[model samples]
Target: PEGSSLQACDEAARKLTEMILKEDGVASISTYVGESSPRFVLVIDPVQPRNNYAQLVVVAKDLKSRKNLEKKIKVLVEEQLPNVQSYSRSIPLGPPTPYPVMIRVSAPTDALAKEYAGKLKQVMLENKNVTMVRYDWMEKAPAVRVELDDDKLRQMGLTRKTVASALYAEISGYSISQYYEGDQAIDIVFRLEPKDHQSISDLGTMSIPTAKGAVQLNQVAYLSYENEDGMIWRRNLLPTITVNAGIADGVTGNDVTNQIMEASKEMRNKLPAGVTIEIGGPSEKSEDSLRSLLGPVPAMLVIMLILLMTMLKDVRKVIIVVCTAPLGIVGVILGLFLFNTPLGIMAEIGALALIGTIIRNSTVLVDQIDQHLAQGMPRLKAVTESVIVRFRPIMLTALTTVLGLIPMFPSDFWRGLAIAISCGLTVATLITLIVMPVIYCLIFNVGNEEK
Candidate 1:
């Protein structure tokens, strides 16, 4: 497909546009042949111009219609345009990758990398969940190679340069002179008309200009057809060929990537020196996002602990409050499960927000218990009265926060975060009101004596 002519890509793009335009819910479609559409919006990174590449942008009536049309178009492309390799996806919300599953195979030489890429593509195609398996380095394109004979060139009073120049001028073109208009100069190109040299045989009989006389090109050279690489991809100066694939319905990118890694163990072991393979795409992006999110967590926690220790002045109470934060994770898990939401980056952020709230509630109850103790109440009375006094405020605070998050539940981006905060806070507040008092009573030996 990479070696296809520009005309071929243009025809395919037009055909695809016609098919998609017939589908319901599609408002309009733009087709870009031999290149991608311009950067209409900020997120779209346009594809570079290539002889074989084409892109289509389809606009739908609404969000619901768009989702449905995406599925239908995918089916249509596969069933109707079997010969054209195609992929359909909406604009990505996160970092954009060419495919869901990308396996990068790098080697010292381009040929070695491409060879492994083909092998890797075969391995990926074996998985039932992996579809549209292909490599960036496509099949080679046909090329004409001219081999000149030095002995024949000398005998004919023509040099290799003269014959090559004549062949180039006939096949492509020769810039004979430049025409100047104002300060701009334009190339005056010249070449034989298409009717004169319509085939390769005509090239062999072309005449080469020389000082002595014009000589036939066939006496000095030979022409043959061979295949050469259409394109090459490199990463960090090393040739890297990435084998990318799409996942089937009801499967995650990570699941298929893991399967491919496990299946390719034998192939990996057989890799030659200076060759390496790595998993990329969504899995790689996810790991990077997680790392960036978690990098500052330890420092933040240390600062929070220092503040907690300074406030309570009691290691046991500080430990109790710190320990209460993680228990909220149970509620977070339950929240995601009950709401049918995946625990994504937004959800993790909501869980982190729960930590501060839990610590705040625990500190308030503990401080109130101390206040009662300072006012000459017995330890048991102090623990009991603190819970009784703070219970309404903590419960009301959680209820109000949960109600405030109701509007976010319907949004695809913030739904997970909303669920995590609402559910985790509700359960964590209960733990703080009930468990905080009990832990206080036990830690201070309050329950051993009623008086």
Candidate 2:
């Protein structure tokens, strides 16, 4: 993943680093450019580590910032990058987990840090599941300040550089060479005592030596608190104020997100016309995926009905098979409820799989009973006899299928499928035993004498 690049990769890396550091929640940022493409690495803080699983890496330049740069990057990478099957704005290269909201706040000075910490703590305590909130950039209170007025420095025949060097000498101290004692070596440096530079008022009164004489800092320059000046966090290319929240064990990411959305909505409305609020996280992806999986169900049903008509040919036989399908589905629903599992996309797909298998079994049983009656056996006798003969194979197939699926129950990928099929088959087998016979007798008078 490393090689020399024709383009100035170092320049790109430096610029990207500068851009990311300006944003909040980012603890540290690094970049690497190889023969294939550039890679970005970011360390971010969320409300909880469990809620933020993936390390988001993007190859395209658009993802480098909050601009819609994905499309442009896709085109460029495709044309320039060799053997590229695809390129993306961001790819999750780590383990998957629920998504987290990004919250940002800036307090450059130590006094502001205390104020900001207090407000953040109050907000976090109001929400039960918020376990952690970390600051991206922090500035401690200034222990000393050295100030030089340009006019006064010019009149005194001394430059600001002279004043700065004198202050640095007093603070950093002069380092002496290492001295050996036995097998150990130690170095010495001289500076003011800890108490001499501990307070703002103390720093203001400290004396600075110059060629003319020693001068107190308060006589020449004003001293006060100051912090690093820069953007701390950003969103959509603008400086942002934000924080992330994690859900409790029993609650869903969506549930926690909804609460945050509700809390922020009133505040968001009060903001000026240029400002806006957006809620994003893993819940959005979950909702979208589920919708995609369920959206095709109705269309699939119509196709299935058409196929059933063509295959079964008889309306009565088709109706019986269709009727039995619901019993299987009802069983699946009840099973999910009993197990306390959410009916996710995988579960819905499992139900679809069960439908096909159940229809096949029903057709086999119903067709056999119809053949027996058409051959002139008494209707009740035919029903009972058909069930007796077919019962072993029917039960055996259902049991074998259920047993085969049992191993998959523990896996996330196939557990839903296993549960749905096992429950559907069990219910359909029972309904076929009890309901099919009653339906046959009501529809066809095989046991009754001619009128």
Q: Point out where model 2 deviates above 4 Å.
A: 1-95, 98-243, 254-279, 337-340, 378-386, 435-451
Best candidate (score: TM-score):
1
Which candidate tops lDDT? 1
Q: Model 1 lDDT vs. the true structure?
A: 0.85
Candidate 1 TM-score to native? 0.86
Give the alpha carbon lDDT tens digit for every residue of 1-451 in model 1.
Answer: 7567788888878888898888889988988888888877766766768888889999999999899988998888788777788888888655667788998999999888878888888889899998688777757897777789988877778776777677788778989899999999999989988777756687777888887778776667888888988778889899988889988876768778989999999999988999999988788887788899889999999999999999999899998888788868988899998988877778988998889999999999989988998999988888888899999998999999999998999988799899999999998888777787777777777777775
Model 2: worst 10 consecutive residues (lDDT sum):
45-54
Clash-forming residue pairs, model 1? none
Q: Alpha carbon lDDT of residue 54, candidate 2?
A: 19
> Global lDDT of each model?
0.85, 0.59
